[model samples]
Target chain A: MTTSLKKFRCAALSVVKHDYVARGMAAHPRFELVVVADDPGVPDWIHQRNQKFADEFKIPYVRDVERALKEFHVDVAIVSPEAERHVDLSVRSAKLGLHVVQDKPLTPSRAEADRLLSEIEKSGVRFMMWNRNGLPAVQHAQAEVAAGRIGRPRSVHIDFYFAKDAGPPRGARKTDEQQCGWLEHQIAAHVDGSDGGLGSKPMGELMIEGIYPLAYLRMLTGAEVRRVYAQTASAFHQLYVDHQVDDLAAVSLELDGGLTATIAVGRIGAASHPSGGEIKLHLLGDAGALVIAEGKPDVGVYYRGQPERESRQRRIAAENDFILADNFAQAIDSGGPTMLDARASHAIFCTVEAALESSRTGKAVTVRTF
Target chain B: MTSFFVHTADEAPWRDAARRLHQSRLVAAAGEAHAEVFDGALLTKPPAIRAALEAGRHVLVAAEPCLPRVELDSLQRAAKQRSLLFALFNPDRFLASRQLLRKQIDGPLGSLELLRSHRWENHIAPAPLGLSGSLVGEIEQAAWFYGRPVRSVFAMQPAGLNAVQVQLCFGPGMATIDYCDALQGTTLTGYRSLSLIGSRGSAQVDDHTNTQLAYVGGDGPTGLTVGEGVRHLAAMLDDFASAIAEQRDFSSTVTDALHTLDVVAALQKSLKTHEPVTLEPAEAVR
Candidate 1:
């Protein structure tokens, strides 16, 4: 069932600009690109939308909940504020009965996180973040593995990176691009590598970036991770980072089903090694094994099976963010869970966060999340 | 059960150790005798931290308060596995004749829940009296900071290793922005003063001062260098952690660290003097 006449009037901020390769995804397709400017002025939607499909922009300061319902009259509201303010807007959007497509790492601290999540849950609005856009190769690999192209899964290793802005913060798209790092900038979604100053890179390298491929691994193998022992290092601390964050990181993670993943990641540092975003997802099962490196920026794979030689070449036709955006829209248009949701992001966040903590303190940090 | 090597002597003191650990299992931990001194090393070397987890066991430690800081931190992390590998000083219960922890166990991040759940059933408490509050705090901080699994080292009193040299590591490793080059030395050596590799590694000179670059000439990087300063601050945490635990005397480690602070101070001098020379001729402190 396709949403035929589902016309949604959308408005976003400049932050949505210059954030990703396919920058204006939210305004395409089903939603009519309505309001965009320096500051998203708050105009009461119900009061201002003289026509039902009319698009408009309002100053953020002037808009209030009542005004939004009375003047602006949009079906839902999208808030892509700064790093610290995402929670408030997401919560407010829910209270206003607007479906929200807020960005990643929704909140910096957990104390208020429950408050926000609880509010949205109660509001009954289909609340979601912009963490979609599955790396094309990652989607392909999951398909191949599920088709039994690879044998039993023993271990998995993954790598993914790009100019810090390469991957969307965790797995979402938003007009909001917050500064990354500082251990507190929850929305700062820079894919950290081995060079990531210290803790930041671990989450960026292993979890955020790795989540795409790792999620694929999880999808392929119906096994869950039980115990994890990890170690991290700040070896790349010497170099200066220009983008206000680290440039390299490495994580050694072991999953529940006897799978050991050794991931190496790096970003640009004053003395950082020259390496673009590269992800090597290695799946080791009982029968045979397969390795997929998103041929991005290079795409290559090596499979061990009936063939004497194992290799393949695939070109990345434009980025697949549209799929991610459309899927989220459709998920909202139809009340279904988006492929990349809070629960999955939280798992990746907690995993990477633990990895960073482990590497920094030389101890395998136990995540205390239920 | 997973087996563990712990120091449980009937004479082990439990009440005093209980004061340090926040958990209340110390005084009550007596009946749970894990192993006697005849049990050998507090921790057997094999089944590494990783293997023990694979086999479904734990590596629990109840050693002297004088145990090396690195080993303690590592043990806490190893406990995060399926196995229970943790340690902490416990309060000696009953009379000192039969050793036992008086109250609850201390873990890396907080309580011994992580290790307890994994079954590292040994109770370590009431280690040496001089254990620093910083040791507890930093271990706790790192435990919380990294979410590592940890427990208390249950024993009657402090062990012997607490001099001051190992204390150098209490500082942040050499990654300061200013001391740039000088920072390398900390990494070359586990810590600047931890230079004594083995009994025969180098000069016969021993003691915390001589080895640590705490002399007149050895300064700069160690002086107020960012990394060195960080290490120095890390050392400060020792005072803080030990104070909270009430286990350590507080002088030797802190005073020595301050004295050695001259190492970094003098090095900065050498850089300005543009000439290389021994910081203090190595005779004054010894």
Candidate 2:
């Protein structure tokens, strides 16, 4: 019997928000891109971008999401839209019995996240949140823990910094200058491909990129965050200051099994680092400690005219995409859980929410269970 | 030459400092010395330090398991009455690498933006040396690097856990210190990493990176060396002698020691209260 490939649709604009997930899933032979779909209510620019992605993939473009889901009979719907639309699109696709691949920052709203999670559980559809846990460094760390190389984990510290410039520096604007519009600035940020939280809502660095590292903590320790004490600052960018959101944040977490962890995250401008940024994990166990630089397992390249921004190209690159896609496929084939399920994603979301609250209240906040 | 009477018990944990003091050529280590060095263990017996000051002997006390502000003030007053130098010994500042880092701060690194230090050990004593006290030296080191009073302090320690994480902001620069003594091991091994990020450059002193490993035949590579520790005591002794001979203030004064103690106290309070502590501007110290 010939094995049938699962058809998937790129559910939103690949041109605007992100196309990496779609391309990664396509790299796996078991999954095939069939159509590009979006809601008719989206702006014309989104439709244009969707159509461009469809043309690039040699697939059909449908403005009506429901019509596209019904007509194409796609097995998976990969959704990467504005931050707020993530839940709605995923909920729509899951209710149609299509497995969903949702982008990060899951959603800014708690209720919406619950709604999508409920739909996924009720419909018995698989859901995977795009994350960096599939990277080789992360995999090695997990394997070491599994092999009992470092014994039972006691504490972990992660430093996740994205060394990217975000427009003008803080204090560059005049005292009387008006705050920049969130939507306009985000759209403009897209020109440099630095818009992680792509929406009108001004989500901070913790909101946008916190999921990846939090997911790492969950994946490595298998313990949920119980409580968190956090501190935040608007240090690097005037945009964050204007929006009153945190561009830099540090959180100390208490977890089950007496595991203590801390995370320091910031979009510390490009000049701070040679590579894209430093993503390091420091884990202490019963027997010994391990320090893993996430950006490592890469080769350093130098030449006369190399862009100062791109210091070293990643080695064994994009394997995370392929690995995550394969894991999802295996989960689908074996009736197992996805690498990052909706509940886990929701837990991470709640952790970030608690951190933000901790920062605001100047106290430790208990993480809410989904 | 002036001399300091080494007044530590033979079995004190700071045998390295005592040995370095004995080996120093700058100042003779004698029984009838006009100055004295007090081990951190003697801090519990405040009268010994007071007696040394009352006898007109300058005194240097180890700044660990820091004394309460009141006790520190009493010692300061005793030294003032005798017109003798009263100093706190923070040997980390004397590490060759740390001296280079301090020099580089103004030489090539320019104004500092961030400082982070992580220390993990397995052999720390219990009680009085709780998570807060274990971080006093690091806090002093951070203040020394920034050369400014801490603007605010935030710290976290999970209940029944053997770790403390603190964030200190000193003007435009910020420092984070993580001290964990929860590791389980039979042997006494300590690992620390300090990184400084400045406007012009960044440097890190990571024991993990600095470890020289040899893979002859074992389950894993054996650590040949893990950076400096005992050797720094000699430099600290030399500096202390120079400070006494030159009649100049020591690298860290009693006032500086009090400030470090206050920071530790505030951190302990913040750990209990779950709130960031904002410090008032400190009074200038002579």
- lDDT (Cα, 0-100) at A201 in candidate 1: 24
- Which regions of candidate 2 are displaced past 4 Å? A1-15, A176-179, B1-28, B31-34, B39-45, B99-115, B125-133, B143-161, B166-176, B185-188, B196-203, B223-225, B229-242, B249-252, B269-286
Cα lDDT of model 2 by residue, A113-228, tens digit: 78877888999989999999989899989999888877778778888888787878777789998878877787777766788878878999999999988989999989989888
Candidate topping DockQ? 2
> How far does residue A55 in candidate 2 sit from its true spot (Å)?
2.9
Worst 10 residues of 2 chain A by lDDT: A6-15
Model 1: per-residue lDDT, tens digit, A1-370? Answer: 4456577654443232123311435445766444432223522332232122223322332333445443555554554434345567666667777666655544444544555667766776665555424666666666767776545555454444332332222223233745344333332322232222122222333433444443554555544443233332222222222132223344444455444443444432221112233344544444434446465434544456634222243345534667666766777777787665554444555555665565466443555442
**Which structure among the candidates has the greatest lDDT?**
2
Model 1 TM-score (2 dp): 0.42
